[model samples]
Target chain A: MKTAALILSAVLAVAACVFLLAPLVVVVLASFSPTPVFDLPTTGASLRWYGRIANLEGFWPALGLSIEVAAVSTALALVVGTLAAIAAVRGALPYADAFAALLVSPLMMPGLVLGIALLQYFRAVGFDAPLAGLLVAHLIVTLPYVARTMIAGLSRFDFTLIDAALTLGCTWRQAIFKVMVPALAPSFLIAGLFAFLASFDNYPVSIFLTDVRTKTLPIKMLQYIEEAPDPTIAAVSSLILLGTIVLLIIADRAVGLSRMAGTSD
Target chain B: MPVTSLSRRTLLKASAALAGTVAMPSIVRAAPKEIVIGGPAGAAKYFNESVFPLLKQKLGVTVLYEGTNSLTNLQKMQADKAAPKFSVVIMDDPVMIRAAAEGLIVPMQASAIPNLGKLVPGAVHLDGMWANYQLPWAGIAYNTKSGAPTSWADMWAPSHKGKVIVPSIQNTEGFWNLLIAAHLETGKPLAEAQYDIDAGFRKLKSLVPSLLNVYTNAPQAMNLLEQGEADMIGGQFSAYTLTRKMDGAPVDLAIPKEGGFAMPSGIAKITGGPASDLADAVIDAFLGPDVQQVLATKAVVTPTNLTTPRPAGYPDPATLFAPDWGFVAKERGKWAERWTTELL
Candidate 1:
């Protein structure tokens, strides 16, 4: 009975992998395909799409925009979310549930809705087309993901250690800086990673908040797909997939894979 | 009496002083330094890849071309209304008309585009929008080898239920599907179809139960048919033909008896963008022969401009489903709402 179950489990895992990998596999095939549209690659594989992606001028601009947005948004989310998480977990403040919920309002709201809401707010305030607008929009969307993960890490923290430090005549700031900061290390990085991933993949907010000048990679990708369907898209998608996989591997080494995968924020 | 008079005068003077302290925005003489233009991903990428090089060389202004679905693009417009980020957007005629009504898109100064007259007659001001680029028909495709289904009526067959796929009539597909339902439900020919929101709603409600699945975009429809999970589906010609010929998918289109919808995507030029000149130039370049050919060859679509010859590797437009643009523009929103109430 045990042997049969193991074999069944193995087959199911392979099937699951194939199901998830199907679209990417089709795209990889199409990227190397000679015919333009939908032919799956059978015999000769060429670097046709890779060449197209390299040659397209939008490649660099969009890539730069994505990296910049992800980096900035992650930094902002980490700061704001970390601060918020600390306050919540410490329970030193009043009405913590309400505060936490208010901070995470963006998560409850759909990205499409949030993008529109922010646009209206921006317009009403007469501030449009600034990097600050995009940064704030991305930060709001990414903050919740960071907060959720950081909250987990904060829970594992030893309150007794914090109390012991305080009783020993250590100031509140010192106890926080040394004991609490070190305790939240693993979770902090995970929060940063969530922040980066959320901002990197965010399309709804980016679409609404961005003007033509401030457009991101996903926005540009959508443009290309609508007007022209080509193998070049596969190349771009493949790059995104590769970037994500690399991050996942690095994250696993930095923090345990189980924790990273266990509670996806 | 003297004290009261003095206090009233002082209050008036203080109010005036506070008003004078408010800051005002600066005025610009030359058009701002850049223009924000937006379109579907394909159009935007074309601007970024094919046209921007020449535009930068001549116009000397940076043009931002945002690309996405028509509905999402509209959402962006509504979202970025404060400080009005994009000065120009390319969208279908009906959407542009509705957007104009909703006060989302701004009207252009006719003289800004010297070639406005180059637009086809009846298209000069279709719903107050000048034609930037004319798109062709959107309709049905089904597999012939799988029992030879022909025409649109066969799509409603019970056996094909759960095997047939059409795009969701919410958000993106909502507008077009509503128009189709209006025509089918009202029994009105293309000529008689007008903006009847009530009729459109009733039609869409009836059509909802007939569908097996309501897809979101071109990809899912094509995927289902390719895998033989679905035998029939609605799609743009771009992926449908590509999948049939190249993917060797057992799927082909059944031309509908009711003329399919032919719509045009146009860029509305607004005053705020500094790169308006560049934006206009880019629009001209998109309609140019070389780029039009590329679009035709790559997406299995034809150039809307008559001067440009059809590129190789696709069926002639005359042979494909005929679309009535006039009818589509008139009844777009009514049908869209009807679709929302019925299908979604």
Candidate 2:
């Protein structure tokens, strides 16, 4: 009976992985398809679609904008979200739970609703800068991921370590930099990763804010699909998937994947 | 020290006020000699690749193209109505009607666009607020291996049962499908039969059994036909079908004996936009013979210009159905609701 249970559990886990990973595998295969139509490459592979990705209309600018927005928004959200998490967990502020909920409330709202509301609010406030509006909206989108992870991390933290460091003749800033930050390093990395990915691939909010010249990678990919349904978009998707894998590998090297997965210390 | 602090605060306030006055207008102001045009992604791709360079060379005007669907463009226009961003917009005829009604677009001066006079009849709106640059007809697209279908009624034939893919009513092709059904049911000319929505719904209800599935995306439907998973796709555009055929898909668009509907891609200038002359010039260039030829051959659309000869292998324009778009604009909501409840 014990052997059967272990086998059954292992089988289910493999099935789940396949279910999640099959589409990604298909996309990677389709990127190398020799034909223009999106089909499995029974006719053998070619690098034609990959070569075409660079010449796609407005491809480079869209990629640059997506990276810039994701990097900036993730950086800002980390600072703001980490500080807010500390306040809620350690400051003994009144209504801390409510404040935390409010910080993460945007996550519960539908992206379309949030996008429309932000577009309207910006219009009403006479904010006509598309790039600025996009960054601010992305900050709102990324903050929830950071705050949720940081709050969970801070809850498990030992605040007395910072007090001990201060008693050892360290200044308050030095104690925090030397003790608290390093202790919470894994959470920071995971939160930043999640926040960056969230902002990077956002479509609904970005769509509302993007103008003629300003578009993110997801919006550009959608436009390419609309323009012509071909394997070029699959190539773009495959590259993005590969990039995400590299990021994960680097994160794993910095901190154990198990820690990021929250399965073990 | 108090006086120094007060003076510094005063200096900061004055500088901030000065900066606001200088920066606000520049943010809102349109760049001179540049016109932003919004339209579908495919059409924008064509213009960006072929037409914009010509406009730049001939008129020295820079064109910025915004590529999205028509309804989104309408919403963007509405949001930016106070200080409009788009100098020109291209939309489907139904959406163009709504845009005109909402005062989002103003009529083009005929004198400003000499090429407007050269468009085929029914290519320009009655009010002259917009003109069709390309005519993509909606008809049956079938896999060549199954042989060509000759009439819209052929969809209901026993042989094609459970082998046809009709578009979901959310797509404009679905509306065209309903109209085709109406034309068949009433046995009247398409122009007159299109008004009888009840008969159309009744006819489409009978076609439900023959349908394999309802598709929302055109390319996916084309893929099914190419793979021979489906025999026919009802109400697909000629341009898209022909483009696929040219790309070696085993598919062809057929204009049935009853006639196909013209889903004209319409262009219009935005109201109260900057660089009105440049916008007009862009419209003229779009309608001119050279650009129209490129539209026909490269973009695979039927050019609206009368001077531009129809490309070989395209269906004649005269046989195609041209609906009263005003009626469609008014009744679309009701028909969509009926389509959802009754058909889906």
Candidate 3:
């Protein structure tokens, strides 16, 4: 019975991996099609779709905006969320749990609901700035990831290390920088990675917020698909997949994949 | 190369170049020769590739194009009412009517656009507020293997049960379903017919059992037909349906005996834009014979410009049943709500 259960579990795990990764594999293969359609090439593979990605209308500006928004939001969320997590874990404030929940509430809310609310709120306040609005919206999106990860990390953290460092003649600020930060480095990397990715690929929230000139990559890609259902989008998706793989590989080297996933010590 | 070794001529040249740079801004700022326009992404490709160059040659101005949907354009214009970001907006006729009422767009003199005289009758949507550039008809799309539907009401026929798809009322294509349903229930001409909300609802609900799927957009509906998941898709247009057929899909579009709805798209000038003249010129170019032909051939839409010859494989624009735009613009939202709440 035990052996049978193990076999069943292994099969289910393999099936799940295949189900998730099959679409990505198809996309990468479709990107090499000589034709403009989304179907894969039957005759031979071609790189014309990759070449077309460079010339796709408004692609560069959209990519640049997406990167800028994600980088800025991730950096801001890392700093603010880490401080809030520290407060939630250490400060012993009244209703600390509620405060933590409030900070992470945006994650629980549907992106569409958040988008509509933000648009109305922005309109009521008479704020028409697209770039600034996108930054604020993405910060809301990414903050929950950072806060949740850091909160969990801090809970398991031994605060006595900072105390010990202080007693060993480190200044209060020095003790935090020298002791707490290094100890939480893995958590920070994990939090930053998740936050950056969440912000980078955000669509539903960005849709309501994006104006014509300030379109993000996902919106632009959708527009491209609407305009022409072609392999260029597949090519772009393959590139994005490649980039993510490289990023994960780097993260694995630095922090270990198991640690980043919170699956192992 | 030292600062002390700088020649008099070089210093004079540097001073001259700096002066030109300072004066260039004022010269360029006095009469800005560029206009910003917004439209759908696919349609924008046509204007960018075909129309903009001609405008630059003839009108001596550049066009900055933004790809967007009609609803988003209206919302943006309303939000930026104080200072309009888009100089010209291109969208559907119903949206044009709503925008006209909201004062997002301005009425124009026929004299401003010579090509306006060449348009088919009733192509002027809201008098001078906007004009229809394309008159695409919405109807039923069926896979040939499933057999052609003879009438629009045949979508609900017992034979097609569980083999039909319908679009959600929120989509532009879906509006046709409501208009067609009203026509199906009432024998009166579409213009004389009311939305007949109750009767229309009854007719649509009766057909719900036949629906294999409900789609929010034309692409989703067509995808079902292509994949053989559904046999027929209502609230789709011949332009897209025919285009797919050309791409070797087994689908074909039919204007039912009751006739299909005319889903005309229009272009308007932003009311308070700084570049209204350029916008007018662009509109004129869009309505011109050459541009209209290119749009018809490339976009698969029927041109409103009467002088532009029909492209191959296009249906007759005269056969389409056009409803009252004003009524549609006013009641579509309520109908869409009812559609979602009362029906699926």
Top lDDT model? 2
Best by TM-score: 2
State each model's CA lDDT, in order: 0.63, 0.85, 0.80
* TM-scores for every candidate against the unseen true structure: 0.66, 0.89, 0.79
lDDT string for model 2 (A61-130, tens) is 7898888789778877888798789888987999999999999999999999999999999989989878
True contacts kept of each: 0.30, 0.29, 0.16
Model 1 Cα lDDT, one tens digit per residue, B94-124: 5666566667765554465544544444444
Candidate 3 lDDT, tens digit per residue, A30-85? 89987545665676999988998887777987897788788778877887798799
For each candidate, what's the DockQ? 0.15, 0.28, 0.11
Cα lDDT tens digits, model 2, B1-344, are 43366447546654554454345332454556788898876565567777788788988888888877677789989978988989999988888999999999999878999999999988889568999998887789999999999998999999999999998765656777888888788887777788988889999999999998897656667767877889999998876777777667778888888778778789999999878888999999889998889888867778889999998877777777777778888888788788789987
Top-down TM-score ranking: 2, 3, 1
What TM-score does chain A of each model score against the native chain A? 0.87, 0.97, 0.98
Superposed by TM-score, candidate 1 places the C-alpha of residue B188 at a distance from the truth, in angstroms, of 9.0
Better of 1 and 3 by DockQ: 1
Model 1, residue B87: distance off in Å is 4.0
